[model samples]
Each structure stands twice: as C-alpha cells, then as structure tokens.
Target: MLPNRSLSRKLKIQSLCSNHKQQSSLCASFSASFSSSSRCRGYDDTIPNLKIGKHTRVIFQGFTGKQATANAKESLEWGTNIVGGVKPGATGEHLGLPVLPSVRSAMEQLKPDATGIYVAAHQATAAIEEAIEAEVPLIVAVAEHLPLHDMMRIHSILSTQSKSRLVGANAPGIISAIGKCRIGFQPLPTFSPGHIGIVAKSGTLSYETVGSLTRAGLGQSLCIGMGGDVIAGTNFVDALKVFETDEDTEAIIIVGELGGTAEEEAAEWITEYKRRTKNPKPIAAVIGGFQAAPGRVMGHAGAWTGLGEGTSESKYRALENAGVTMVDHPAKFGSVMKDILAKSGSNFKKMEQSLAQQRRSFHSSSSPLRPQASRSTPLNTRQQRSLHLSVEQNATILKNYNINTSPEPDQLPKSTHFVGITVARSARSPCIIAAPTANPHQLPHRVRRYPFDYRSGPSQSAIKSALQHLQLDSAPVSSKAAIVKLINSLWTMYKEKEAITATVSLALSSENDDLIIYDSDLLFDDAAFKSCKRQQDIHSLRNLTLLAPTDLEAEAAGIMYIPLETPASLKKDGKEPRNLIGTLVNGAGLAMNTNDVLTLRLLKNPQSAYPPTTSANFLDTGGKATASTISTSFKLLLSDPRVSVVFVNIFGGLTLCDMIAEGIILAFKEVGVDKPVVVRLRGTNEEAGRRVLEQAKLPIRAFDEFEEAVREVGRLASGVEAKTGVTEEGDLDEVLV
Candidate 1:
C-alpha cells in the first residue's frame, strides 16, 4: 500500500516536471532512460530540495574590499570552488581570482553557480538585483540594516523574476563542515561532519554550539546562519524542510535568539509536517538572551524585544508545545540532541528502511536514473529588448553609481523596442514628461517640453495665456485640476494612438504633493532616468509622477534615495572649529542611544564651554561589520576634514569585534591618523577587539566603559589632550590618572 502511494506521488511530480520547460529536456531524457519504478527513486534524491553543495562554484561580489579579499583567500584555501570576484572599476585585476565589474559579466566569464555578497547596506539592493538578473542559484549577503523597502524590492525579484535562494542580508552564510564547503565567514575549527543539522540567526552562538557538538562527538551535516536582520532572506522553516529531506542530516538543532518569531513559525511548519507524514525527525533548540532586558537590543539587529511576540518565553512555549526538545542554553544543545536521537532509534531505523526501499525499487527496475548538468540558454534578442531598457541607458545608470560603464553607446548593441514621448500642447498650456532617449548611443538629442512659454513670468500667467489662445480663458477648472486632466488625457492618447507597451507619463502639479526619491532598489538601466534618476533631488520633482504599467517594477529600478539628516560639521568664521563627532556603531538602536546620551549629557553639564548644540552623524555598521568595512569607514572619516574626533561603538554578536579591530587597524595604516579617535568594543570577543587596538600603538584611545568613551570625545572636542595608560596585557580599563 505504501509503495503504491509513493509511486502515485512520484508520477505526479514527473507530470509537474513536464511543465518545467527549463528542466524538460533533462526530464524527458530521464524518462527515456529510467523505468517507471526507477523514475520514482530518481525523484526521491531531489526531494531534499537543497541547492548548494561543496562542488558549487561561487563568485564574490565586492571582491576588492578588505573582508572579501581576506575571506575569499580562506575559502580558496579550504578548497571552495571560487571562480572569481566582482569589483566595478577593478575589472581584469586579479586578487587571487578574476575580478569583474558586475555579476552579469562574471556570469559570462566564470558561469559561477552562486554569489557571496560583501557590500554595505546602501549598495546591497543593487548587488542583489544584479545577482538575480544574472540568475545565480544562490546569494549570501553578509551585511545588515537593509531598509525594509529595499528588502521588499529584493524579495519581489527573487519571487517573480528568478529562482535563486537568498541566504542573508545580515547573515553569516551556510557551512557544510562535513562536506568541507562554506559560503560565509564561519569558525572552521569548531565544525565537524556528522548527522546533526544546525540553523541559527546568531553567528557567534552557532560557533559556540558547533564547538559543543564537535566536543560531544556529534558532527554537523550543515550549519546555517539565517541572518539577524528583520527581513532575512531565508528562515527556520526553509532550513527545516531541507534538513528533513537531507540524507546526511539525521537530526536538527535550532539556536534561536530572544527577538523574532522565526522559531514559532518553524514550530508550526514542523507540527503540520509531522501530523501529515508521521516521519518525525529528532529536533533540539536553544533560545538565547532570555535574561536580556526588554526594549534593549542584543548584538543582532533582529534581537530586540519591542512587542511580546518575539520574547524567549513565547518561543519556548511554542516549540515545547510543538513537541521539540528545548535546551536552556546552547552549551546543552549537543547533549539534548544526542538523548533525543538515542531514544528515537526505532524512528530513525524506520526512515532509513523507507529511503532504502525507494532506492531499491528503482535499482530492481530494468532502467537507470542519472543526474544531468544544467545549461544556460540566452534569451532571444526581441524577448530581451522587450524588458524596457536599452544597453545605453543601463550604462548611463551604472555610471551614475560610480560603477564601471559599458563601452561607448555606439559600440553597444541596439534594441528594437522603442517608445515615443510627446508633450500635449494646447493654446492655453503645454506639459513636459521627461524620459530617457530611445538610444543614447545613436541619438544624443533629449526630448523636453514645458507647459508655458519660457518668457512667461509665472505658471498662472502661462496657463491664462494658453487658455486665452484656446478660447477657454473663462474655464471653471483650476490650473492644478486642468493639468491633471491633461496628463490623464495624454496617457490615454499615447496608449491608443501609438500602441506603446511601456511609457513614462508625468503629471506636474505641486498642490499637496510630497517629493519622494527611491534610489537603491528599483532604479536600473533605462528605467532609472524615466523615474527620478535624472533629477538631482526628489524635492524638485515632487509634482511629477512616473507612469508605468507596474509601479512596483519602477520602484525596483535603482532610483535615487536620500536618507534623513545625520551628523555634520559646520564652520564659524574660521575661528575655533567645533567638534564634528563621527560615530560608527553596529546597530541602529545603539547609534540612536549613543546620540541621545551624548546630547543629554552635553546639555546638563554646566561647566561645558561649547553649547549643547553639538552635532553627530552615526555611521551604522549594520549587524555584521567585517574588518574591511571597518577600515573603509575609518578612512572615510579621516578624509573628511570636518571631523575633529571619531567615536566607534561596537556591540559584536555574529560580527566579531576582533574583526572590527582589524579593520580599524587597516584604516590606521592606509591613512596615518592625525585626529583623535575613541573606541568602545562590547559583546562577543570584546577583549580580543580591544587587544588588537592596543597592540596597533596608533593614536586610538580604547575604552571598556561606555561613559568614559563618550567623555573622551567631549574632552577631545574641547581641545583637551587627555591621555591614559594601558596595562602590559593590553587591558584598556586599567588606564587611569
């Protein structure tokens, strides 16, 4: 009866695979080579649904950056098949691997299966788009604080246009210690190959758990850090589904934190799957930061307790009720998992028999099932052209990002797809809808139209003159309403008369309209100039609306986005320069808290010579800051002449403080520091982080106390050269008068 049920399911899967045109040829060959029973066994192997493995070739985005270069070397050393790296201007340059400008170019040259991204928060969106467009099977982003809007855009691309699986925006990536391949930065020594599968949001915690498991004679099949961002690319349920089907993974370990309901969601999926299939897998979990104070963020971006839903107690109750073994601490994760596996011997044996039966059934049949390689087929030129942007526009957009541009417009391939832009002119008014030229490489002329004559003094006068010319001077409609009506009419006219598939229709009326610019996610190629790319600021184009068939698609184009005001320096008559306190922190909550604390203290201190009006601009390092980003940020501050002193506050969780220290030291080397800098390192590996700075012997002041670090910044601002001594052991706190 069970064999019959399995055969029926297998047939259904084959039928579905028939519709998968991308996999059809392989499927047809599979059907031709394998008997009906053998085909069932063949599909069983793919049941795991895992995309990445040890043999998967990968490319590193942001390859020239400090962290990427260092990590890529380590990955290569470990025998990871790293094909190349992508660094916009440094293409053709080799840092142990071929470096190209974009993911598409890298795809053309290397044909890598995956991309591991190491870029800042602001640039992550564009990097994601490139990877998705190039159709990389997997992407692992190692950064955090990705704006929710930008994440949404990335999510849309993955869901609709691509079949790629994104691992993290603030994640540590995935590691198959037993398989001997890692996609993200992980402590390799702690992991060993075994039957246990582990998943977590905290990288540091995962390291501790993996070590514990290794010590207990338990090895991991795969360990994944799903990221500590609010919107992680992958989740606990996704990991569990893969692990459930993984032949290597016998049991699962979940190391959850205080924030986020990912654990609860995973519990629900597990409960349902168990109820339906009754093929239960042993699972143990450890929820971290239970003793943490509410409203205070832990080291992770997503590890904050705002609402009660993501609390440790809530997650504990949910998982416990779902029949999962719960460990009080990560140290006990291995032992508990072992006990569960020991007691579930019968279940394990039963599952083994079931898988064997499926394989045996196929082997007994007079046919063989073989795996095939994937092939890439280029899209037809007309189909590619229909995507709404020319190569010239794409190059222009890339140039604006300071990225390497394509060859001259004339050298680029032309697109057959064309859309016309014309202004609707009446005697009383005229209008201009800005759009990119159809082919910048061929035609350098721009189309521009204004509703009123240039000689007219005001918009109202122009409208009135145009109205008089049209014999409608006494029309009852207001100028704003009239303009809106004209825009709608023109949009309809273009669609009906020109049979245009895509057009950028604009309505210009400043009445109660707010200017909004979206730069990171949605603006790419020619879609950029059609939206808000050409305009320097959103404020100037608030009245204009970009008309597209899909507004979401327009937003996904890498349009310009301006962040809120942060810290800046101001000069006063070239006298005494005020302190421009440049702060660098790992999380937004910490950055805000640091700013608030400094502001309150400065205002309350009566003896302070400078007014409480001190300004600060906090550079959020996101939840995961690599040594490279740390060095780059420090150098950026040094280049800014406005900054008198710099303050670095880091609360390392998954991001090791020692790595941050390495970056700071690298920056110190790149640009010999003249400005006074204060650093406060906390959380995981804080001591090691401080020691790195102490050993550097640069003009950096390390502090163990947060208040003291803040005070040092004030002293430096007041032109006081406060000095402190460091212990022989590099203990920063030992320094005193």
Candidate 2:
C-alpha cells in the first residue's frame, strides 16, 4: 500500500518530469508497454465492456469541417492512431491522411474500430447512423444541438446493436493516459499515468478532474465523458463496468452534474459491485451544480433540475449513502481519490488478480456481444416430475411463492349508498338529493331513510333512535353536533315558512358511516362553487320542493344538477350577472391562481370599467376532466347570459395540453363560441396542443405565459388594449415566487 504523505511528494516529482522536454519520449516508452499489459484479461461475455487502447484505429465523420480538422490534428499529434476520415463528398485527402466519401468506404480501407463525429447539427444524426452501420466498436459523438427526438433515435439504434459503445453527443470523449490515446479534445499534458479511472458527464468537469488527479499524483488509467445529454449513448454504469475489469484502473472517480439520475443509478451499481465482489475498488465522486439555481440550464442541455428531480444535493446524498466518497469541490476529487488509493491499494491489486483468474476459463463460442446463457441448464424429466410431486404433497410451495391456485376470492367491503331525498321548499326548505350509485360492484341494497320528521316535532328518543338506526351513532362527535345543529336550524326555518337554496358537498365514509362536509353555502360564492364543481366528493344537496326525483339528473350534476325544464325555478338571481368572466382550468391550484390574477387585475384597474361581479371566475374543470367533459363545461359557461368572455388557463402536469386543446376544439364545434376566448396552455405537450388549436381556425388567442393570458383576458373584458405580450417560457422561480 502507498503511504499518503510520501505519495504527494512523489506526485510533485512526477509532475516535474512530465513537463520536461524529454517527457514525450518517456510517455512513448510507457505507451508502448502500457496498452498491452493494461488490456483487461478479465473479459466476461456477460458484462458489456469496450476496452479501448492506443492501437484502436479511429475514423472521423465530417472530416472536412473546420472543427473536425482542428480536433483530428490535435488527436494525431498526441499519438492517436487516426486511420482515415468520411466527408461524403469533396474529400480526397486531409492532413496527409486519406479522406473517403463514406463510412463504408473508409471502413474498407482502414478497418477502424472507433469513430468521432464533428458534423453540423442537421447532419449529426445521419453521420452517427453511418458509423453504426459500419459497425465501429466505439463512437465518440461531439456534435451539439442535435434535436432531442433525433438523440433518442440514436440511443435506440445503439441499444439494438450489441458490439458498439457510444460516448457523447456533447462530450469531450475518452482518453487513456498510459495508452497515449486521445479520442476527444482533452488537454493531453494535464493527464499523467497512474491508477484512477474517470467517468464524467461534462467535458469541462472531466478536464478539471484530470488536472486535479494529475496534481495529486493519481493520474487516470482511463477517462471517459458519457455525454451531457439526457439520453447518452453510454452511461456511468457502462463506463464503470469497463473500469471494473481493467487491471490498470485501481480506483474510479465519477464526475456528475445535476439534472439526471445517472449519478444515483451509479451509486446503486457501486453498492451491488461491493456486495458481489466482496472487495470492490474504491470509488469517489464529484457532483457539479450544487449551488446552481433550480430549472436554470447550466451550460449543458441535461444540466437543469426540477422539483424532486436530479438535484446536486440529492445526487450527493445518494452516492454518500451508498458509501462513495462524495467530493463537494472539483479540486478535492484527486485528493479524495488519493486518500482512498492509499488505504485500498493492496486490496484493489488482489481483487484485480482474483478477477483475472476468475475469467481465465470462461469461454463460449457465441459472440461476446450476445447475452450469455444461464448457468442452470434445462432440467430432466425425472427432476421435473419430482418437483411436480413435491407441489402435490405440500401446500407450503404455494404459500412460499404467494401463488394462489385455489384461494378464496377477495370480498368487496360493505358500503352505504344514500337514496335520493325529496325537499319541500314551502315549509321544508332543504334536503339531500342523493341516491345509491347503481354500480355493479356496489353493495346490493341502499341505506334506509329515517322515519322521524322534524316538522312533526318528533320526540328526542325517536330522534336519537333514528340516528342509531341510520348508523350515525358511530360517527365523529363533531359530525353529530353538525347534524344536530343543521336539524335545529332547518326546524326553525320550517316553522317560519322561509325557503333557501342551500348548496352543500357531501362525502360519505362507509367505514364509520360518517359524512365529510367539504363545502356548504347559503348563498352561492362563484369562486368556491367553481373550485368544488369537479370534486368527486361534492354532492349538491338542493331542496327538491315541488318535483319527483330522478337518478340520471342526480348522478350527472350531484346536488347542483339543474334540469333543462326547471331553468326558471332554478335561477337564483332574477336577472343574469353582467360581464361574467368564466375560467377553465385543470387543477384547483391553477384555478385559484388564475382567479387571483383576474381579481388583482380588476382591483388594480378599476377605471378600466370591469363589472363588480366579473371578479368571480365561473368554471374550473379539474385534472381528471377529459375532452368531452371539458367541452360540456365550456358549453355551460358560454350558455350563461352573464358570461361575456372565457379565459382558459391550463398549467398541465399529469393532464396533457393536447388533450385540453382537443377539448377546446370540440367545445367550439358543439357550442359555437362567439365570445372572445383568451387561452393559455403550458407544460406537457404545449407546442403540439397550441398547433391543434391554431389549425382549428378558432378565434381563441393562445398565450404561452400565465401573466399574458390573464392580462389579455382582463383587457378584453374591460374593453381596452392589452399591454405588452411576452411569450418567454416561465421558469421555476416564477412558479415558486
């Protein structure tokens, strides 16, 4: 084992020698013997390992490009085996090397094992596909700004191919200090031969790591950038596997950033590797973006974090919890790795020897790229028959496997289903209008109603007895008090011969027969009414004074179900409310937020001449609302004489924007909306959904930002011009703020 104090001194000496004029000759000598001896002898057919070395021939796609020319020249200067290049056309020779027209042509000439892509964003995907078709063992993709869907396709193509391994779309690529090979743009002098293997997401971070390691006298055996894209060709786990088998890689240092689960996943593999090998090589990690603001894109495409997503703090905790040495600073990575190497050096060397010995006799004629067969071969008939006999002889087998071959079927729990109640508005003002849901899976019978009438002044004993009979005896004390209070209040009103249109949302708990009161109103509060409109628990208990109760009407609108024929009697106000602004949203929070915005806009711009009652938004279609349901909601809003304009504000999460867009289109077709509708759609599939609305040729104006949508709606309703229209995407800070 190396001593920590002495190692730092040795590192200083080596650093001096590496910078000397004769360092190139010294590096060449190390390279000649390093690549062969360091080539992993512990190759397992089961493990996906791409052992790259100095001898590996490399080809360049888009060799004619300026970026490619510069990088390729640097690679050649660093002793990289650059065989040929592919430029499609106008490429005879470049930099004393033959430049071919295609990957296939270049492959025939050079038989390249690896390729680097440095093409324009438009042609990057095609270049990668060409390299894959030619079956280049390793591909280091350095092209940036490739479309997200195109990158997904590239990953798919690589996944299907067994023999190939991909590095990056926006990566620095891989380097072997000992092998004297540089595939990507890594500062060669910063690297020194030692024992650390680095697998990182960011190219700049990897460079910083190499510098740190070199300074610490713990130079890398292999350094691979797994790309900064969300979906890279290769991941941290793949690179770790290669390092795990390499004899030269005594320890590993993973450089990760925020905004991906790659670091967390690597921690899981590190834990598993420790358990399987019993003596794993030490691993240290540095997770970048610790101080980065959430949802702010930090240089790379995949470096932005969201709520409960790949944050640096979360990733650090994950690795630390898995026993990995988590380095907070880039400069500390080398020192941390040096400390680990000092204590674990001898054990790592022994593990290397053991791994090599273990794989010496593991041979199969099948291709290494193909999955290895299971160790257990097919069982004989006798063995199978013995197992069948055991199953017949014992019930333990079924219990052990939780296999229910003949177990009793699970019984659905008993539930109370309240039947529809009749309310007399003349003397008996309010009553519950709920009937048992006639669902097939529901209990057979409905809950029987109480016979004690409040109008007749039933005895206290009868009232208490009725409560017991209805199973309200086991209800919560507060609920019982509420019921008693409601009954007394109703009895007082019944005596006075006064009527009120009471709206109450009912939720029944079958376990205790307790009714959960969500919301109640003597007079309708439009904001509260809209908020509870789509709640599954809400049952509008209206007084059915002069008509027979119906099941379909009761189920469709709950207690608030206004019949088409009973419009005159059901109208609470003698005249319709003027200049009503209706809102359509997918969630209660969004509904509330949009309502708040409208209220503020009206209060702030009193002179803009908005109606006093226009503050209350009339509609909220909760998260579960489908296109058909949303259409129905819009129709009802437009049907109202009070409503002049509708503002549809949807911040979609679980619900998609496309689905909402389709609903808006359906509503326009069904209701023929003539009113000015200001629509704002954000979140999942926003662009596609916006296109759906735009193509429909509807008069609805769509805004990308919430403030703009609200401002436009307010301006239209108040008969004024909208201020400024900003379509910039809202960030996490806005949501939080």
* C-alpha lDDT of all candidate models, in order: 0.53, 0.53
**What RMSD does each model have against the real structure?**
20.1, 28.0
Instruction: State the local distance difference test value for candidate 1.
Output: 0.53
Best by TM-score: 1
User: How do the predictions measure up, each by TM-score?
Assistant: 0.46, 0.43
User: What is candidate 1's lDDT per residue for 3-56, written digit by digit as tens?
Assistant: 122342343243233223223223333334322222322222322324456778
Least lDDT summed over 10 consecutive residues: which range in candidate 2? 378-387
lDDT of 2 by residue, 1-737 (tens): 11132332343243233223222223333334222222222112212435667878888888878878987887788888898798786568888999998887887888998888877666777888777667666778876545444554454344323445677776768888777777776666566766778988765456556655655555678888787664576678778998898998888888787654567668777877988996798888766543232223434555544211334555667778778886543445655665677687454332222122111111111111111111111111011110111223223322232221222213322433222222211111123322233121122122222222222332344335334534556667876665555444433432232212222234345455455432222221121223223211121333233333432322243211121111122235775444557777654323433443354344333443443423333244543457876777676666556667788876554356899999999988887888899887755566789999999998988976454555566666655443342223332111111
How far off is residue 253 in model 1, in Å?
1.0
